[model samples]
Target: MQKIDIRTVDVIQYLQPLREGGSLPAIVKADDGFLYVLKFRGAGQGKMALIAEFMGGELARAIGLKVPELVFMNLDESFSKTQPDEEIQDLLKFSVGLNLGLHFLSSAITFDPLVTTVDGLTASKIVLLDSLISNIDRTDKNTNLLYWNKELWVIDNGASFYFHHNWPNWTEHLTRTFPLIKDHVLLKKADQLTEAAVEIKRLLTEDIIRDIVSSIPEDWLQSESETMSPADMKAAYMEYMTTKLSNIDLLVKEAADAR
Candidate 1:
């Protein structure tokens, strides 16, 4: 499998904190002269959330979905020294290493399901993607979707693959039906789930899965396992995803039934 290439940038400035979620992700300017929304490794679920975000975003892009460009953002301890708020300073102090960043969509608007009309195929594909990744945050209350340039963009996938939080028996979740599909924001419009399944299976090949899983930073996997090395963790992720892909039909049926 060809290795995936993700760019790494150093954060030069902390712009502001986006206080919407518990994670307290912030907008920061990187050395590359661009602004990005940085997900801190020190916050909420820590590096595991970044791992899930990377996997979810890359998988979505592999299947022809619009996701903001993901980058490895390096944070320095000095950035925290002059911070006014104790909470923000403490967050930066702890996150003084590699964190995940997404390219900022300057004029993007939050997707409001009440006013937005998504087509059947698009909605079905989104539903399938969420089901495969086991993302539970895309409800009407916290739709993580954005509208930019008249197109839908997926964002904040840190909530995907939540099984990693309790890593003892992660395999048991591979073929389990995603009951949370009933709460997905797009479930009502997902009429072309069968078609979406076929397309996802075609696009999200083993090579793609391997490439994405391999791209996960070793630091993120370090504290997650005591017996398993980072390499072992990567292999486990590959296995989980491949098993999930093979059982896509079960996910499709569950999603269709939920609607």
Candidate 2:
């Protein structure tokens, strides 16, 4: 089994807020002297969003897609107290523990499907990955994709795997065809679904899924359920993903039919 480990960095300074999203993620300088887009744990959608972001980004990387590096960011209580803005300070105060961050892409531009064209294989892989993870944010209006360094980079996966929000019936979602995949921004360009499936299956194995689920911090899973422990939450995620992998053909068919 391949062990997946995420680097932990202490946030040194909160630069500014990226106000586009509801979470109010900020660009912060980490102890490593690098700037990262930090996702607050206390934001709307809570730590579940961070877990989704972490798992989704790592899975995208595993499937040969370009994703910004993800790291575990530590936000100190004292650091939150120094912020001048009331709203920002409140957000930081609630997010004092561990949060998630992505490496800041210097000059990345939002991917405009109308202006920029993507190849069939790349589009198919992205579509399939999004469908597998149940990501609803990658639509025409909000393509959570970036064009940087002459390549397409995936980002902001906080909306994936939403079944966790209603844990009582997570299994019901495992077999879903994800009909919303029709709205995927890359659906029209994804003509190579079969080829993408073959490659993705080869790369994403059961062991890899297990490693990704295990990497989620226990603190994030604590508030999920009183009856279900963190370990139980991890197990649920593992089951959800493994079941989704086994039923990948359902998602592929859905995408193909949508196209």
Candidate 3:
């Protein structure tokens, strides 16, 4: 991720209350003079989102796009420990208190169903990666694209692989899901393609990914596997992750030639 412009952030002091959802999500002020999207280990299994988030955001940053500043916080459990209704607790499985900093940009960048050209390259890269990861969350409605410093940024990668735990057909290639691959004009720019490739290479070799994903804590993943064996989940992760890494190389090769 690009370092935050000093002018945009100062002392991250207090947190402002925002809308509530899976794990009492909030917007927090950061020391760098920016606001961060904060997720607390609230009443549900929200913490699992952090795993996807850190992994996705890290890969995205290595690819040379602008992603929000990320900090793995050790939150004071006192402030965020209020449990939700018992029935609600019984209903969900997620952790809370994951805070992600924002750029506090000057314009509005909506996840509009219509594709725009200004940041199309970055958006295309993100869409392509999401497809590889089976990220079912970045649909037309909640695609977390942002506008900062007159550039496009990708955000909110929490719901990826939500259904992969017991997915019967885990080996299916994910590239088939993207609807705008042909429409994004910026795909021609290919600015961050090589960078993305480097990052993908680093991640596939990292032992942490293999160690952590097995305990993927999403409610669906945790609950669905009790009736069946866990081998398919592992198989699916290997299948798509390898596909994503290979495409990263392909995109990087395209970028090297384009420039």
**All candidates: CA RMSD in angstroms?**
1.2, 1.1, 7.9
Measured against the true structure, the TM-scores of the candidates, in listed sequence, are: 0.97, 0.97, 0.55
How far in Å is the alpha carbon of 38 misplaced in model 2?
0.2
Q: For candidate 1, which ten residues in a row score worst on lDDT?
A: 223-232
* Candidate 3, lDDT over the whole model: 0.49
Regions of candidate 1 where Cα sits further than 4 Å from its true position: 1-3
Q: Which candidate should be chosen as best, given lDDT against the real structure?
A: 2
Which pairs clash (backbone N, Cα, C closer than 3 Å) in model 2? Answer: none
Put down candidate 1 lDDT per residue, 1-259, tens digits, no spaces. Answer: 5566899999998999999868898999999999999999999789989999999999999988999999999999998999999999999999999999999999999998888788888899999999889999999999999999999999988899988887778878877879999999999999999999999999999999998998899988998246778897898899889998999999999999999
Over the full model, what C-alpha lDDT does candidate 1 score relative to the true structure? Answer: 0.92
Q: Rate the local accuracy (lDDT) of all candidates.
A: 0.92, 0.92, 0.49
Candidate 2: residue 49 Cα off by (Å): 0.2
